[model samples]
Target chain A: MAEKVIAGRTIQVNDEGYMTNPSEWTREIAAEMAKEEGITLTDKHYAVLEYIREKALAGETLTIRKIGSSGIVDLKEFYQLFPGGPLKLASKLAGIPKPTSCV
Target chain B: MATKEEYPLKKVLIICAKGNLEDVYAALVMANGAVMEGIETKLFFTFFGLDAITKKRMNCLHTATVGNPALRMPGGLPFPTLLGILPGVEAGVSAMMRKEMDKLDIPPVKEFLEMITAGGGEIYACKLAADMFKLKKEDFTEEVLDIITVGQFYEMAGGIGTQIIFV
Candidate 1:
């Protein structure tokens, strides 16, 4: 485990840069991590992020196509927004662990 | 069984040997999960698995009702295997399953392939299976990178930390 300091708060992250503790997350930390991942947080990004965060907190697995059908963005926009691995990257940016299920 | 840390998998090779909707989706789901976890992933289609990558037949896959021990009714009732012999039963079951998955917003077979590739996953069809079916390269969707032999499949699975999963 590695520790990263975002917004002057130290938090543990896995080797893949996902937060180990969800309770330690803040919007500022998300912004910082998104920057590190070469993404700028937009309103659209926030929409997806918030949705994932909520679903994750409720103990639901999130998936790329599920998010695409969320009425927030389509699949093409999701791929465009998150690039390499949309659901994985988005969940990491949302300060959550990678979902174990498929989309 | 190997411990997780003992096999810090670098890649996952999923072998889709059955073309049944459930079987193909199982392979797809696992490969998609691997790519999401930052592991390199590839799907190999063989036997009936060709139905998943073939452009004409991919979307028309049916559920495997006969001999499916896991099949059950909605209320946890075990579905009798003998009933699977009914002509329309398999298709009906498949349609119901697809409807449930659609409600969860699961992508269809084609879009599922696209999503996996977009996440840096690769798709391959087995050479012998293709040749037996007389399938030209053009018969498959563009997402298929190549039709390869089982030896080549072994080679693809040869690297350290590579795991071959049969589904």
Candidate 2:
């Protein structure tokens, strides 16, 4: 019924549990959130976030375990760059209407 | 933005069966795309997929040729399997793929994985596959979140707006 900001992205949830601003969020918002999370934003981060956001908008879901198995060797450094780490960054970026029970 | 009753697949599970460059890259691209679109993504490595995450063999991924329609020979000729077995065949293909990926500014597999995971996607190893491959948990990518079975994978994938993909 109201718009809420989760991970720097505005998401509107209806009474029937639907998302209004599903695709409104952008990679820029993800970057801003990363900065707000006290992680320095880099071109690499932008690239990754942009890629992720694009996929999610295309109707795909991502998991931390999948991300880890993707062979990105610099995982620790990347997570260290984030305050809450990759999962938080992704959850924030996804603009999920509510906190997931799994997390 | 108007609330849509049905959201697109908000979660994805990528099943990796081969560890070749193309296979691994395909998985990464999908995962990256999922994260970008605000979806939760996961990649499951089984069989040869483990090679892509294994530090020792990650850089050694080869090209697929047998029964591949995309295979080509010099001067537009079709390359035979014998040619594919030549010493530099795999290396040459791998190099070309890397070059193209570089031109597109795609990060290396390792970095791309990091970005996806760090962005909120999860990465897991198939426990059966790992055991079959005689791989210890330590042999997997350092970023691996867990080793799970197919049932566990299904459990994670269960929910509305979830997709399961094999690559």
Candidate 3:
């Protein structure tokens, strides 16, 4: 229930700063969001984020197990990309809400 | 002025002591969840739980059809214990459970352990139980880091914001 100005655009967000509207996401915005977490976006990082945004916004349940098999990156790489809380951080940078699945 | 202080869980020690399908899964799910949260996770398998880490038995775990009051028929009918003793019935039920979990993207026990470790979770076997069962390190999957005693387990469990859970 807040608005964040990222990459020069005011976007709706939740209390935790997760974007409320996935459609408002842009590559620039994602980079900025990741920078806040002290992560620099690389091709490999964007690959995982883009994949999840496409599937999760389309009403798919996202989990590490599913993402591991997405062919974009493996499970170990996913953790390395997002460091702390891979699924949660990936979802946030993807401009989607925090992931809900446990696995 | 008063300030808000947040004390988040920094580490978790989970102990699994059962080999039944549901029991082992409960431990796996909790351990995996902790790892996903970026928590420092440690899992110790002892007693019957050792079967879960045993290379030969990890993927072939079974649901205890008998002596389990919670088990039920497909349509909510109270399951009769007599049917549990029937050959293949328990196996069939366990298979169905696996199928259901698979549909939800839950991996088998072996793969689950891999996922946890891939996220930096540590797995260990209890030395006392390992001796009682006459099992050795080679009998466990590559996922296990070592076989250690309770004292060693506690040594690592020490720290602020750390919690130990027994299942």
* Candidate closest to the true structure, highest lDDT: 3
TM-score of 3: 0.98
- Tens-place lDDT digits, model 2, residues B77-138: 78688767778877887777787766655667777777777667889999998998899878
The runs of at least 3 residues in candidate 3 whose Cα sits more than 4 Å from the true structure, single-residue gaps closed, are B1-5
Better of 1 and 2 by lDDT: 1
State the lDDT of candidate 1 residue by residue for B7-55, as single tens digits: 6888999999998998899998898777766788999999889999999
- Between prediction 1 and prediction 3, the one with superior TM-score is 3
**lDDT measured at residue B135 in model 1 versus the true structure, 0 to 100:** 94
Query: After best superposition, candidate 3 residue A58: deviation in angstroms?
Result: 2.0
Error at B77, model 1, angstroms:
3.5
State residue B9's C-alpha deviation in candidate 2, in Å: 2.2
Q: Residue B75 of model 1: what lDDT?
A: 96
Native contact fraction, candidates in order: 0.42, 0.09, 0.88
lDDT of 3 by residue, B4-114 (tens): 988899999999999989989999999999999999999999999999999999998999899989998989998899999999999999999999999999999999999
User: Each model's DockQ?
Assistant: 0.42, 0.09, 0.90
